[model samples]
Target: MLLMAITVTGASTLTYFVNDSFISGQLSTASSLDTGTKSVQLLAYDTRDSTTLLQVSNLNNKFGDQKLCGVSCSGGGLTDKIPLNGGTEFIMIKIKNNGINSIFLENIKLNNVVHAWDSQTSGIALNTLQDLSSGGSYPHDGTFSIFSESSIIQSTSNEIPNGNTVNLLIKLGSEDDDILLNKGIKVLLNIGNLNPVEFFIDSGGAQ
Candidate 1:
C-alpha cells in the first residue's frame, strides 16, 4: 500500500503598483510583512521600467521673465523645479506570474528613505502602502513612508498567480530643476512571510 500527497489552493488577485516620487533614496530601511493563512509575495518588473522616468531636460520654452525683463533673477531664491513647463506625467504598471508557485500578494512597504525634494520639502518621505481592498487611507499620514534606496533594492516577492495580471495607476507629479540627473522614483515591495522577500532594482531610474 502507498500514500499520496494532496495539494490545496485558493483564489487570489495580483496587484500592480506605480510609485513616482523622483527623489534620491538614502539609508537602508526595511519592513516586515503580514503572515496570514494565505501566502503572498511581491516581485520586481523583470525587464526593469517598474518605476517612472522623469524627463527632467524636457522643459518647455514658453515663459517670459515676469519679475524683470532682460535680466535673470533667482525666482523665489530658487530655480523652479517644474517638468514640461508645468505639464504632467502619468505612469501605469502591470505584472505577470513568472514563477512556478501561484500565490497571493498581501502588502507593500515603504521606508523613511530620502527623496529628491526631502531637503526642500522636509518630512516628505515614502511610507507604507496597504491594499485599497483593505479599506484604509494610504500612507496613514505620518505612519508609513515609501521611498527608494540608494543601493540595490532587495525584497522578497511572492509568486504571482499564473496567468494573472493587474493594471495599477501611479500618481503623477511634475518637478522643475536646473540641475542634472534627478531621481525619478524607487519602489521596494515586501510580500508575505514578512513575505519579506528581497527583490533587486538594477539600472533603472526611479519613477
Candidate 2:
C-alpha cells in the first residue's frame, strides 16, 4: 500500500508540470505574433488625361510632393485640373501594402478640412470609386456629402493582398460654383485602418 501511494503522487506531479509547460508555450507564441509589423505607402496622380499612369518614379515616393492643381496653375507646369463636364472629376491613387497580412479596406473617408476659403463652403462629394486591381471588387458609390470631421465618404469591401500595389480612381462631384469658386483645399484621405495621406489642391477658383 505504501509503494502504491508514492507512485500515485509522483504521477500527479508530472502531469501538473506537463500542463503548465504547454500553457507557457502558447503564451510565448501569441506574444511573438502580436509583434508582427504593418506598413503602407500612398501615391496620388492627376486624372487629366484618358490614359493615367502610375509612374515607377512615383511608386512608394510619399516624401515627394504629389499635387493636383484645380482650375488654373501659373508656372509650376503642373497638370491642369480635369474638367467637371460630367459633373465629376476623377482622382487616381495608388496604395502599396507592405505588410505581412492582407488589408481589408473597410472604408474611405475624409479626416479633416485643412483649408476652405469660403466659410459657407462645406466640402466635396463623391460619385463613384473603385480599386482597379485584378480580382478587385465592384465599384462603390460614394454619393454622400463630405465635410471636415464628417462621417465616412464611402464603404468598401476591397482587399489588398500583401506585397501588392493597387490603384484607386475616385470620382469627385463638384459643388455649386458659389462654393467651389476660387477655393483651395488641403485634405487628408483615410483608407481602411491605415494612416492618412495628405494632399494640397489648388482649385484655381474656377466657376
lDDT per model, in order?
0.26, 0.37
Each candidate's clash count: 33, 1
> What are the runs in model 2 whose C-alpha is more than 4 Å off?
1-38, 47-85, 110-156, 174-207
TM-score, predicted candidate 1 vs. hidden true structure? 0.26
Error of 1 at 90 (Å): 4.4
Worst 10 residues of 2 by lDDT: 56-65
Give lDDT tens digits, candidate 2, residues 1-207.
999999999999999999999999999876554322235565444333332223321111111122232223212332212222222233445556677777654334322322111111122232222222222121222222111112222223255567766555443422211113224445454434424545554332111
Q: What is the Å distance of residue 78 in model 1 from its true position?
A: 23
lDDT of 1 by residue, 45-145 (tens): 21122222232121122232211010121134212222122212122234444444564444332222211211221233221122222331212211122
Against the hidden reference, what TM-scores do the models get?
A: 0.26, 0.37
Give residue 163's lDDT in candidate 1 (0 to 100).
48
